[model samples]
Target: MPSETKNDRIFPVSPEKNDTQNIELDLLLQAVFLKYGYDFRNYSKAHLKRRINQRLNISNLETISELQNKILWDKEFFRLFLKDLSINVTEMFRDPDFYAAFREKVVSVLKTYAHIKVWHAGCATGEEVYSLAIILKEENLLARTQIYATDINKSVLETAKQGIYSKKEMELYERNYKEAGGKGELSNYYTSKYGSVLFDKSLSKNIVFADHNLVTDGVFAEVHLIFCRNVLIYFDKLLQNKVLGLFSDSLAKRGFLCLGTKESLKFTDYENKFQAVDKKMRIYKKLYIPK
Candidate 1:
């Protein structure tokens, strides 16, 4: 009595599908959030795709779905995947102009504070962390200041704590230190051993390296200065605004916030809350906007 449909049609029907890799990728991110509690949902989609594809290639998996399955089931694979996604790209005295500007403009203000707190958010591998320490040491503020360096990736945090780096890297680091207005040779802080350099243990005497995800974590300290450079470019606008708000809450009155040369407070909702200390170098001072 009922008319035969595709079941009785001449050609056999293939399974119905709308399987785009992007869809699978979104699902993968959602699964990761639910299963692991690491929020990568709002990261730049293009960046996520590229990094995920790289993982796919390395794992010999054919699709994002396959990679997602492995990531959910295998803890080790998830660690490697997190490392790939969090991509720690950093160097000591990166963009020497920023450090030089900080020394000139920010150090004088910091000297006024008897006890100072500094937060280095998204400190990858601690290159810049030690760079700041060197500056504070030269300025005689290291003894009075507490430096808190945080990164989302635990592996990088561990590496940052060790404070070891390749000798080859020191060549560029030394040049940068001098350009950033170092008074003495950068080598004075570290000893060479087996083609590597071990930085002075005393440099980290006041530094606290910890795992803190700006995405998932709340404000951890009220500080005199915050250095978060080259870390926001990877986040989307929403994430950027969210993290910027966190920074606003964490900074003390008239505290300074330093970003990468390419990053700025312009176009952000809190742009009005900060006045540029060095607009060209991307340093800003929090304003006392009456609530």
Candidate 2:
């Protein structure tokens, strides 16, 4: 319960009290699922508890039950609580090496296709989507590619649609772009004004930003590539396997699937369904048949 500690302990208490707290957390997640239809029941318990505890500290609540009461009645507070639960951390060309590998390994396959459809799952704030757009543009593939950028949070989807980011963050993103094998000036894609940068609307001409929840929603689109980086780390094994199955069902044969460096399909039920394209980069190709 101490601050600045990397403690796996959710909260310390007597065994009896700990059991009650666990039940409280489960009931709260169930309520959220039933009322809002945004399922978080299968999410990693430690992660959820950490986030909920942070809210409890801010709201001066002593228990998870207290937080649940406010969530059921106070719509505004529920919105803030929901936002806390949805992990939206992301950056453009997040892992430069992954993008670099994509440039080297995936682009060639894409070139073979007259048209391409890419699904960017859990595309928080659209940074990576724009990064891919710039890559495709330089490769002369943007005109033929349709990018489907989706996230469970509608607010983040709007942010992605606008393609605006803080001017201050451009320095880091520019560095990432270069490391990711950017072929042209990064500034050419966006104009800066009044402390913000608004990316060219044309970058999104072939892109679609929509609200899609991997937890409860069904397969959305058949795509050639699926980029879901830095997302599965927050999910439990069960949820991870479930989402992987969804990706398998949606991807075209021999299509590519990219995940965060920390995520892999090694022990999942769908492992045989994908062939590792770059194990270090966590990129995989959907096999035509399990091998």
Candidate 3:
């Protein structure tokens, strides 16, 4: 006997059911883009599915259609949904080896520049932003550097601008700082209050926190260095290429670009545009071919 069930009832699943769900998901993404300005159309479908399913479970919604209806009708609910889609998993001095390589290989080249402009794309909550600031300060380059740290989520940007983090995170951050070849104590960079730590205001003096979407936004600035680690993995191949093109256009000739350990420029349209500086750290320098 063929039966259809709802609300946790055991029923025979059909291929048609999966097709319908995919269509519903597509419609929901389209609705989000039309209603809000955010574009998630080209995002990785697998990543989208996991995040959407998690939101559904959290909101106790039965279907993607139902979720879409709430998102469209309730502005506050959409804000919550946007947070779910945003990737905010970041820590100070993440991948210590990458920072070590940056200090060893990239910092020396940056010294030659009179003024440095850095773009930290997808800089969620600004932990790594401050980490870079601390490095620059130690290397005597902070005074001449201006870092633009941008993210799509305004809520996270607000948190980033405040530069406050839970004190509980300091132990791990301190350990990461030491491993990243810190010249002095990590504790010198922040002050503790109640249960949170506020990073030194000087660390953020040259940083500008702004809302920028990598999916739909164009070239932000002609930067000397770009740190967009662990961000491209969430995008599909097409979006990855599009964003890489934007980065390639945004970077100055002979500028440096740093990606996550798992991310790379291989098989992309911009592969030949960059030469690897530290392949293991996913660092690359733009080629200086004459135009």
Candidate 4:
């Protein structure tokens, strides 16, 4: 069997070996589901393999089997692995054009509503959630809005609820805020101390941070908008469809759905159920279809 080097760790590569690894991976995910109730069984295989490989290198383990044993017996180790699997890569006002479009297209319709309920699914670390709040505040809609930001990872949700971020990211966040049509200086929204910036607590006053798994959880609220960016790409097609169904069921009539740039409903079961409000930014409005 041939071996390949990844992150300075050698992994055996062969058709038979790969087959064995696949089976082991399936069993590992099943164990995680049965024990911890975290379902990654329907996640993208490539993503799973990459993250598992990284964990293997970090833990100095050679195979998936060893990692599985550690996860099954050690609750702490599983928590660390859960962090690795959770998609926590996010930034304030990420994909500025998307926010800009949301401001131009979605905010107008949102203003017509008496009260707005926003479900920011997979809101890792809450940067984007605050970004949305800032936009709503500027539009004078924050007071009428209730934002529900949920994530599968409890650790990241804590960080999101804290509303504190490293000072190093301010430059980029400021740029994004400006590009997203921020009315005032991003600095005005936060105060800096000891190399960290704590965003204004007022920004989170209307926001609720909670634990909700899109995979295993059912619809909790009928929302006017759902912002689930860059998350479906991590899921396989079946899981994506399942999640889209959940979103469809959860959204109110003519509500909005925003996805990451790389994701879309083009080939999904709910493609026709949504009409693109800003196709370039992957923002869509739910279409009310009569049975």
Candidate 5:
């Protein structure tokens, strides 16, 4: 053997270094899990890579190792990365057609339930929470309902609790509301101040905004309906199945599960466990008895 160096890539370090990078990624996931308990280990490799690249760019890191080093040293960086990883990318009534179908099909059945518990999982900035609130209010069920709005991003959670959005965004949201079959004036929900829309404080009376990570946390409450839209796409197949498992367990008997327009349980192992209540709306009702 002759003198070798780390940069040699063959003499001291193996020329085939893919295994080393994989081991590094494994260790990084283990470290993050053990430290913050926000599990991203099973998330989709493509999405994770995208998010990781975004984080690295924002942090000005030269390599994944550099990002990992910063994450280990700066807890704040970890939180920021989590925000980049989990925050929903859009506005209220994200898909108006979905809401319209939901109102027509699901709300009718929802009215039959004496009381309701709705969970808006990965509810970034609370727009969907308010949307659901409006629907429930119109249906005369808001007074007897409990809404749990959860997300992994603490910063977004705070914003969701505040329920303040820019006037411009509110304008678009109002349009979305109207198109989604809103029963009353969208202006009734919020007041304008400083060029922004501040939603009525009363709307959130029955709502709870809390930090909940689908990746690692267990179900906090059993719910009559779970609206976990656009969140599972961030997760890999294994993680998607795990999160769906938690949802299946969390939903009450004969409950509803709503996913994003692009997502479905068809390929998931849970397909047979849920029946399509609104095919186009991506809404499914859980089976009362598993076949």
Candidate 6:
């Protein structure tokens, strides 16, 4: 006997189905990885989706296939897309309360160490890196400390290395500074030139800004403290756990981990590896356990 299927029972498909956006997105990610060597395949789907949608609009293309065509054919589009893709929203002393809490807590423990190694993961535009440098300097540890400031975006990394920022941001940064228990006038940190600011050169001299991916990359340095603020929010649970494991592995024994206010390790697999140093701030102290 033969089977007769209704016309409406067909699979009904278009080669351009949006759900295949995943397949298309993987292609584009591969293209970027091969062409630019910046791998972003592990980033959460929501983060990638927003960036891809924005890029699709900019290219005036309704579908992922169209976007891929343009991305493969035009290099400039990828450059623009890269800027929009990597989250770069940052400002000096972003969370005054966090800094204040760190001063009252983490710095006290750090004072006991003869030297310090800090890793500022995803250091957008270098504001937080410089902020840490200033704090370490005031604490008399800057001279004995080394800082590694890393981000996946090259453009923002360049800006971070340059240590230049819009002078207009100073008012807000200053308010944050004062709120963070700043010891002196916030203006003392930088000199205004034209409409921009050039932070003191001494602040970033010990900082090394480099390209590092939280995914698909090995640890570049041993660090006593790793401050990865506001970065894990965009990552899915899997990537977040992977990054936490990497941080925990890279961290020196009994090192400290400071995360953003909204981010925490309570749900992560590494939860048992680190003890809460400051529960309110998500600052943790790597517990001493025999291997």
Clashing pairs in 3: none
Which residue pairs overlap in candidate 1's backbone? none
lDDT by residue (tens digit), candidate 5, 44-102:
76666566666655566645777778778899888777776775686888899999999
In angstroms, give how far residue 246 of model 2 lies from its true place: 0.6
The residue-by-residue lDDT of candidate 2 on 1-291, one tens digit each, is 557553323454467866888899999999998888889999998889789877877777878999999999898898899889887888888999999999999999999999999999999899999999999999999999999999998888999999999999999999999999998878999999999999999899999999899999998789999999888888888999999999999999899999998888986888888899999999999989755
**lDDT per residue as tens, model 1, 1-291:** 765652232211233322377788789999999999999998998888777766766676767888888989999989999999995889999999999999999999999999999999999899999999999999999999999999999989998999999999999999999999998999999999999999999999999999899999999999999999998888888999999999999999999999999999786788898999999999999998777
Instruction: Give the range of the ten consecutive residues with the poorest summed lDDT in model 1.
Output: 9-18
What's the distance in Å from true for residue 251, model 3? 0.6
Tens digits of lDDT, candidate 4, 173-287? 9999999999999999999999999999999999999999999999999999999999999999999999999999999999999999889998688888899999989999999
Clashes of each: 0, 0, 0, 0, 1, 0
10 residues in a row with least lDDT, candidate 6 = 4-13
Q: What is the C-alpha local distance difference test score of candidate 2?
A: 0.90
Q: Provide the overall lDDT of each model, using Cα atoms, as 2-decimal numbers.
A: 0.91, 0.90, 0.92, 0.95, 0.84, 0.84
Off by over 4 Å in 1: 1-19
Better of 2 and 3 by TM-score: 3
Q: Give the TM-score of candidate 6.
A: 0.89
The lDDT-based order of candidates, best leading, equals: 4, 3, 1, 2, 6, 5
Superposed Cα deviation of residue 94, candidate 3 (Å): 0.3
Off by over 4 Å in 5: 1-24
Per-model TM values vs. the true structure: 0.93, 0.94, 0.95, 0.96, 0.90, 0.89
Model 5 residue 96 lDDT score = 93
**Residue lDDT tens for model 3, 144-193:** 99999999999999999999999999999999999999999999999999
Model 2 clash count equals 0
